[model samples]
Target: MAMFVHLTSAANAPGVRRSGIRAASHGQGSARGVYCFPVLPSYTLTHQWLRELARFGSRGGLVAVHVRLDDAQEVLVGRYAERARMAQVVVSAAEAVRRIAALEDPRGWEVFVPRAIRPREVHRVRTAPQVTGWRYLPDAHGARPCTCFGCRVRGGYGARRLRERLPHPLDGPPPPVRVLLAQVAAGDPGDAAALREALHWFSMRRRGPLDRLAGLATHPDPGVREDLVWAVAGWSTPGVTELLDGLADDPDADVREAVEAARDPIS
Candidate 1:
């Protein structure tokens, strides 16, 4: 939720009716509150307000503030309405936009000041609701099984998404690899053989004269070393297996585990 703080001209009469904007326009305070109008081009006002709101919300700030002149017209009012709907603020939209525009903008106020504030909410954990009705509905009646993550996300199926993202022992970034990884790690051999074939192709490509990332895979950093192990583990080529077999004795346990996990042979 977003909040707003509104600042009106100090000279304006205290009894101003916000809904009676026309009355405010005819009143005596117009000359004093000129600073309350937006300094940006009329068209850019919306974009500017959006950016400011996002910046403020990202930081732990409670309220979004804008200053409004006593006589701001309909255009300003509409802009405020839009912003007010999206953000939680202490002041009305018209007032906040007007005030922010009136203030002297420091260099990089948008970038620097907001970066110091952190979001109030952190690490939101989403759990999927239990499926009580899918079983009662007819299967294969409406939507075909979606292979992409979009449907799963829409249904709030977090566990399935996690299972889908994990890498298989033999496949890399391809669909076949993703499927193999989705299979139980200990219980399948036909799927394992298919994974072996995919790896075999990957191995040939990685070892061919065109390979560029091979050098980085052998870098001294532990992360790099472990990535290399997982990357090479998915290939079926003798060259890749040979390298992993040699690296089984690597000082890093992560790298060793990756090497051993990828050593499955087709019977």
Candidate 2:
């Protein structure tokens, strides 16, 4: 069972009027009573409030904080949403409404939820009543469309109306080897384009020139080291396997994994 808690104002009269919503907007009062509810945009809350909210989430409590892109804040990846350390289920408000309506709940929150969502309920677990697939249905009706993670993510609506901003560049000839190597040596953390182009130099055109980048084996950046591992794969260059063997115990775990993977590309 999914739950919603709309955040709205106290001055614009009756705040949120939906089922399970709370009405505590920006200016409720300086010293306000605290509710034990999971907060939306919990990142911006006071230290105490944030701690309490995080605690709720830690003990098997629901961590479904929904938000809409009303402004231009970039959606953070790995650090926010699905991959956030605490948040279990985060999505947008409009998507939540659509999903909730499909619950087919005979006597769920729809029975108690006001015509307006009252954001006041503290969330716990959200287990469904049962699970029935197409094979189990009496009429042999097929299961609902695949709402698996990959499909659902790909099914999300795109802003097709937005104009394309980037220019379409034609593929040009590769730069001379010396210039490419210079770029690779100068690559920095902020920009890996130079290093990537160098990797492209080795990957394409049936070339197996692994010896050219042998000096880069001890490059500081693990990313560069990892890329070198890939570039050397299937190249049959003499002493290349020995070099990779030395890097098998790379300091960076990712680099070590990359080295292991390169050891046997066919397998």
Candidate 3:
């Protein structure tokens, strides 16, 4: 939701000069939409470094700039300073110092620095957290994992029943719930894209004995229903599309919009 970028102490100041060079990329998967945040102390905040970070973030890198604002500076209160989809500011210097002082996970490597990008010893800087996201569904009834957008948003009574049968495990393992909550809090675009993709994929595999999505369509959760409305529009399958098309006249305005998005030629 709120992305963070951590710049190393050496490069934390706003006025620090950048070499105008690109840092070495860590391999493709290493770059799975995650950015390295450099961690530094609050006193390191310089105009040059901040400007460089803002510039880097604008180019699609998530950045975590460390800031140790006093109780009155209110560092975390500002809206994000950059406009990149893949960017964020993190107050990591304070976090790192706090954690270190508290003897918590003293491993220095926690502050990541992409190995490939350093131009020189001075250019070597540490980075930020490697965060990933996913939304979880239950294995109740031992249901196979599915991400059909149509099932998530369409189908109908049967689909809703199926979803209820396999409702999300809200209190199970902490990871999925944590990720889900973080996504909700951050309004993450990548997370949103992943959800849409997963639902679409699950929706397309339905030539079987049970219509999974048709079951989810009637899911009682208003949140689930809202998700479905968005998911159904991206589904390209004719069968799924046709099914949604029929719901265009459904009494619910959101449901009708989803159906129209699915079936309307001009949409």
Q: Write the per-residue lDDT of candidate 2 for residues 51-125, one digit (tens) a residue.
A: 222321122222233222222211111112222243323343344344434444311111111122334433321
Whole-model alpha-carbon lDDT for candidate 1: 0.34
lDDT of 1 by residue, 51-85 (tens): 22222122222112232322322222222223324
Candidate 2: stretches off by over 4 Å: 1-176, 185-192, 205-209
**TM-score, prediction 3:** 0.22
In angstroms, the error of model 1 at 185 is 34
For model 2, state the Cα shift of residue 239 in Å.
1.9
Q: Which segments of candidate 3 are over 4 A away from where they belong?
A: 1-210, 232-238, 265-267
In the order shown, the candidates' Cα RMSDs to the true structure are: 22.0, 19.0, 17.7
Candidate lDDT scores, in order, read: 0.34, 0.39, 0.35
Clash counts per candidate, in order, are 19, 12, 46
Per TM-score, the best of the predicted structures is 2
In angstroms, how far off is 9's CA in candidate 2?
63
1 or 2, greater by lDDT: 2
RMSD of 3: 17.7
Instruction: TM-score each candidate.
Output: 0.24, 0.32, 0.22
